[model samples]
Target chain A: MSLPLLEVDDLHVTFNTASGPVHAVDGVSFTMESGDSLGVVGESGSGKSVTARALLRLFAITDDVRIAGSVRFDGVDLLRIDERKLRDVRGGQIGMIFQDPLTSLNPLMAVGEQIAESLRLHRGMGRSEAAAEAVELLGRVGIADPERRATELPNSFSGGMRQRVMISLAIACRPRLLIADEPTTALDVTVQAEILLLLDELRRSEQMALMLITHDFGVVAATCEDVQVMYAGRLVEKASMVHLFDRANHPYTEGLLRLVPRFEDAHTGRLHPIAGQPPITGGGGSSCAFAPRCSHAFDRCRSEVPPEVAVGPQHLSACWLAAERAKDATEAGRPWKRDP
Target chain B: MSAAAARAVLEVSDAVVEFDTDGGRITAVDGVSLQLSTGETLGLVGESGCGKSTLARAILQLVPMQQGSVRLEDTDLGSLSPRELRRMRHRIQMVFQDPRGSLDPRMSVTALIGEPLRVHGIGDRASRAREVAEAMELVGLPALVADRLPSELSGGQQQRVGIARAIVTDPAVLVCDEPVSALDVSIQAQIINVLDELRDTLNLAMLFIAHDLSVVRHLSDRVAVMYLGQFVETGTASEVFTEPRHPYTQGLITSVPRADTESAARLQTARRLVLGELPSLLDPPSGCRYRTRCPYATDRCADVEPPPDLLDGHHAVRCHHHRAITAGEHQPSSKSMRG
Candidate 1:
């Protein structure tokens, strides 16, 4: 029937740094339907944020950056569209919230005015009408006494309140897609739960597709139905939330999962930390980027990159061992042993 | 004396720290007290502005306290002479949250780790350099990176340097204030392992202050839950995590996101969900600071302040309704402010 709400095909983003060309987001592909929630998990420099920003052409201003591949959102290829149309699509159809609200929100303006400005530009409301809607939006985001709080500057609000103002600004136009990049990373656990619940409620009420990019697996399990695990700017694993936790196929995914200390693991002797840091690859290579740090890596992983293989329905893992084990399990007529 | 008392390297009692801000006087550490024994980890956890950091600094005597005392192995830190205090400071050291910001970008790693020893006149220059190299190796940093600046090191390596500097003095107690919060998840695990190894090897008692519940539970022997400059609960790690008594402790535990899918629904139904942000320190709630957002709060919570009442041996809870709440006798009168 109809196409998905958002389809990303072989996305690649490279930046010309002082050292050399850095392939930050390399050949990532995914799709999302309306009301779908997808979590992108990766460590710093894994290029999770770069992929999300590339969709909105947010990197157009950077002089030494190259973004390639098709990003089709609601039938329009966002990359090929003109600057004017892209502006209309930016905050109007695809809203985004960043990690830190202090830098994202305008420091000089009143918090309400920033939201109103977006509404006036995107929704075509008059100044006064937009101002009233801004207050309402603030209240909708659970800000107390929105009328008075709206008049105050961004600095007057606490970290959590500033984030709420940012959320209000993003959803002022009721965009069809919401991209939240580490929205709760800077917030406390109590406030983070509140914010996540708020975002979940908004997504359901508006029927918007959500793409949440964060390093925390806990946040992903709590909010998303599907998830993609990234390592060294590559999509190493993609699966349903339950399936990912239950039967993660990629070594990187398994290692990352083990890194988190669970409440049940209290007094556990030591954390099973991945041995090495994520690499900063300057250019493309045939070998898998994560091979240096992966404990399960072998000669094939060091020589050539692995292709995406389906370990189960809707579960894709890019690893040679996973492919080999899948074959072995099929031959033996049994499920593959994860540890063995 | 008890075995715990005999082994304790740090003893802090009735510590009060206040600041004269433009809004008014704010009490950062309000009569907080704890004991940290050798080779033990006492996790001090709370939301931001809850005075966990202040308490850590007060223990180190970095911040001046309004009242109470901090003793380092029978020696009162507050009563020490200036020279003696400088010597006493060497027995306790701090590792800050932001490794890059805390470290000097201009200095090499060797100098950064050796500064404490140099300042304390612990050894000759050559001996200090040797100690620096050993400390770097102890934290899993390669010796080749000793000459590099903090800016050149990776986030994980920079944190290793921070840890190296803290232990270079061979401190009896190590106060890590959000040590791994700035790093990524994988890097955070590495740092935690390093800290764990160091604590065991050196027999260094650690005061691990963080907002991360899982990390605290992983490393701590005991846990103290702080809210609005006061400890709401203090108990063994297992008791605090599995059977949190205070409403604030329950709410905080519930807020943590779990990776397992089977427990997701259980976490939600068991959630206490304390609403709203931390209140202004200058004008905290009259009685229980957590009562403003606590679902089980009532008129008694506002009318009278609850002391830290000991229950079930050493598990202490600062809540008037904790006994009834644990007995299933008290009902929540108010819901969380929002979904």
Candidate 2:
């Protein structure tokens, strides 16, 4: 097989807190092909966003932070790159859109100038050419009357429009990969759909890979072709979107799926929530991180960390009881259905 | 007023809330009329700036209503004096969206829940502690957590403490304004289940307000869909979810990503969304607020406001072209569904 467009191997990120060193990202790994959309899903502080930021080297590396990993993009190891080279690759070759658009864009600059600034810096285009490109990009993202809206500040746009502007700026450099961190969190449901669609269209048209970091499974199902489920700073499950949704092997994945409210399901009794909260990560990472929250956890699960086992083609789950559950389902004549 | 057999714990008649901003006087809640019977759960679903939160606040008298009246049981909320209102406030409580911001950091869980009862002079010291313990138990928090500060607990636990504080007074009406929006999905479900169990055990009347229809659909008996400042549609949960009348309602239902759906096309086709954004509430469109985004909008829609037309005994919609829109005759060539 050809090398992945972006390959992450044995990534480990830790932060030194007063309590101890928090193992935020523990040996998390994934690979993405060109134009492939991969979703990194987890609850808050699951280390999903931190892992994304690590790809861009956003975290400070002092005596506090200890980052050891290999992140290869276009055959270049991002971890080994110097600050100057990393800066060039950060926004030019790889753009990022943050959760809050209001804070992401500069309040002092006009919305259009922000987009043009990226274009001028990265593409080395003339001022007039960059300005024209900025307006065109604004129009492309579904902003009406781009010329007038371009001159307006970020405060002038609504939450949805500001997000569109952020997306416009991110894509202005035509980066090979776009890392969007909870891009739709601040927007309403209708506006969320619109922004997702816009991103989808841009990804398809530009053939740019998208790394969407969010906790919403619905958003993951809609946009991502592959998914990685994180729990307590580790990747517990990774699979194609279809397999993850239809035949989720991991207990955590199953719990997450059941947690989301579906439109078709009638209001029965209360929702079946996973018992207990996620554990806080400390330096020591010998035991299974999810053992405290897992109902099916055994003595082995509590004492030893489970290794990632291949459940199916392109599917992996790190849980001791997944095989047992799969066997039980099969014996009960309620086998997991595979998507055609 | 008491003609209906069911006793209403809370009722708002054509309640309107307006805010005076630099732009102008914005009608946040326009002519919204609703009723929450004793022990009943009413879901208020809408987009941001649709005035759902404002309406919830108006019921608790947190925000002063510009017009109409809110009545809790036999008492008129708007006409109550300061002393009377303070006494009545214990009968109604609220849980806001942000648990961290809503809760006092310095206060312990014990103190946070016990403060309301103490303020109301409901019991002595020992009895108040017992009440606090009972409230904590009602929301499924551990007894040990009572001594912990709000900062020591997780987001879900903080919200549970918020719920405990709201219920400590044993309020007849509980108004939850986007209580779970800020929580994670797993934590959100836990909080929602806690709320559901509390309502069942206490027989409490609740106004569950949220921006997501799916969340509200699970908890509410009857759901009201608000657009701009007005309720465009209202009906029983089953009737509204399966058979939405208003175009905006249909669009909202469609916009939500369903687990059963395989493609965005199918989802988009399910609810054909109108192109433009929501018009400004200060200087809204001349006629119906939704007319600006309604696909079946006509010149009549722009000129005269559409009145709420009853589709059935329980379901109602505000649209000039409900007949054609529901019949799917005037639907655009997209994948939007017809009634």
Candidate 3:
């Protein structure tokens, strides 16, 4: 098989804080084929965003920061690439859209200038050519009257309009990969739906692989093919969208799925909130980080870290319960899966 | 006091709050009316600029309403002097959105919870100390952390402290404005569960305002869909979810992705979206505030605003074509902009 467009293997990112080394993105490994979408789903401090940011070596400048393992994109090691080369890769090969479009865009410059800046720098387009291209890109992303709207300051644009501009800039260079970190978190629900649809359309037409980093599971289900559930810093579960939902192995994943209020079904029981806060990463060593919060934790979970074992073909879960309850998933008509 | 006033712990009618800005006057909370009975939750769901927060503030008399009546139990809050208002505030407490911001950074958890009791003159120092421990235990926090500051607590813990402080006075009405929106999904459930339990134990009347309708459904006995500066729909939670009358309500509900696996699958298919420029409420539409983005908006809508008239005894909708929309007779030109 051809090499995946992006391969993240055994990635680890740690930050040195006063208390101890904050282990964010611990041993996260995943691969996305060209045009494939992978969603990194996690709660706050779960390292999803850190994993996405590390691809661009965003942590390198910060002091006492450590990042290990490999992030291969189009046969180049993103982690090892020099700043000069990485600059080319940044807008030319990979683009990023962060949450809060209000803060992401430059207030001093017109919105068009920001989009054209990327095109001019990355593709070496002339000023006029980039400006024309920027308007078309804006229109392509569903912004109305893009030609005029392009010249207006970001403050003039609505929240939804600003987000569309952010998306326009991220896709201006026609990058191979786009990392969107909660692109719609700050947007209204109606606007979020439109943005999600716009991104899906862009992904399909451009054949760009997407790394969607969001805490919202529904957004992942709508946009991604492959899903990775992060807990503490480790990838607790990784599977296709269907497998993640239908035969989720990790207790955390199941609890997460159950906790969300759904309009489609009548949720009569008290919401089953996972007991206790997410464990603060530091000072603790070698044990399952999720053990203390996990309801199914046993002596084995506390003493030794469980290795990721396959529950289904290509579906892996890093929980001791996955080994014990492998038959449970298959019994629920998920016959393709096996007990680890 | 009317007989209905006896039942409703907090009642607001024709509440209108406006702010004078450099551009013009902005009506943050339009002529809106709502009531909350003891142990009942009336969830106000809306987008950021839709005045849900402003309405909550208006109800609490935190902000003065230019034209409205806020009756807390038998007392008319607007007529009260500042001194009397301060004295009356103990009857109705507010839980703010940001736990960190609402709580004083310098105060210990003990001091934070005890402040309300001390302000209300509910108990003596020793009794207040005993009550502070009781409040901590009620919200599931250990008594040992009473001395700890708000900064030392996690997001969920801080929210629990916020909840504990709101409930410490045993206020009859609780106006929680997006209390759990800042928390994680798992932690959101824990907070929701805690509030749900507290509602039963305290028999409190709550006005829960949040943007997420799903969370509102879990907690609210009734739901009000707000847009711009006005509510377009109000009904029982099940009624609003299952058979929404207004197109804006339809679009809003359809937009949120449910956690169920089937919803994800359903989301893959083509869907209608309610999207148009949300008009500046500074110069809002002549009639319906949502008329600009509304799919079923007609010339009549521009001429006059549709009042939220009750359909059955409980369900109310402020739409010209609500009945037709629910009957599947009024087919919007853009089917996706159902709300």
Q: In every candidate, how many clashes are there? A: 0, 1, 5
Better of 1 and 3 by TM-score: 1
lDDT of 2 at A80: 95
TM-score of chain B taken alone, candidate 3 = 0.93
C-alpha positional error of residue A282 in candidate 2 after TM-score superposition, expressed in Å: 5.8
Model 2 segments more than 4 A misplaced: A60-63, A282-284, A327-340, B1-4, B261-263, B333-339
lDDT of 3 by residue, B1-339 (tens): 122443988889999999998889999888898888888888899887899998988888888899989999979999999999989898898887889988999999999999999988998999998888888888888877878999998888899999999899889999899999888788898888888888889988889998877788888888899888888898878778788888788878888875445554344332453646677877888977777777677788899889777877578999988888768787666644432
iRMS of each prediction:
1.8, 1.9, 2.5
Give me the candidate number with maximum DockQ. 1
How displaced is residue B194 in candidate 1, in Å? 0.7
Assess each prediction's global lDDT (C-alpha) against the native.
0.87, 0.85, 0.83
Q: After TM-score superposition, what is the CA distance of residue A104 in candidate 2 from its true location, in Å?
A: 1.5
lDDT of 1: 0.87
> How well is each residue in A31-85 modelled by candidate 3, as lDDT tens digits?
8877888888877878888889888887655557888999999878899988899
Of candidates 3 and 2, the better by lDDT? 2
Error of 3 at A307 (Å): 2.1
Give stretches of model 3 more than 4 Å off. Answer: A282-284, A332-340, B1-6, B260-273, B334-339
Each model's chain A TM-score: 0.94, 0.94, 0.95
Predicted candidate 1 versus true structure: per-residue lDDT over A126-236, tens digit per residue:
999999999999999999999999999999998888899999999999999999999999998878887787788788899998899999888888788999998877898
RMSD of each: 2.5, 2.9, 3.2
lDDT of 3: 0.83
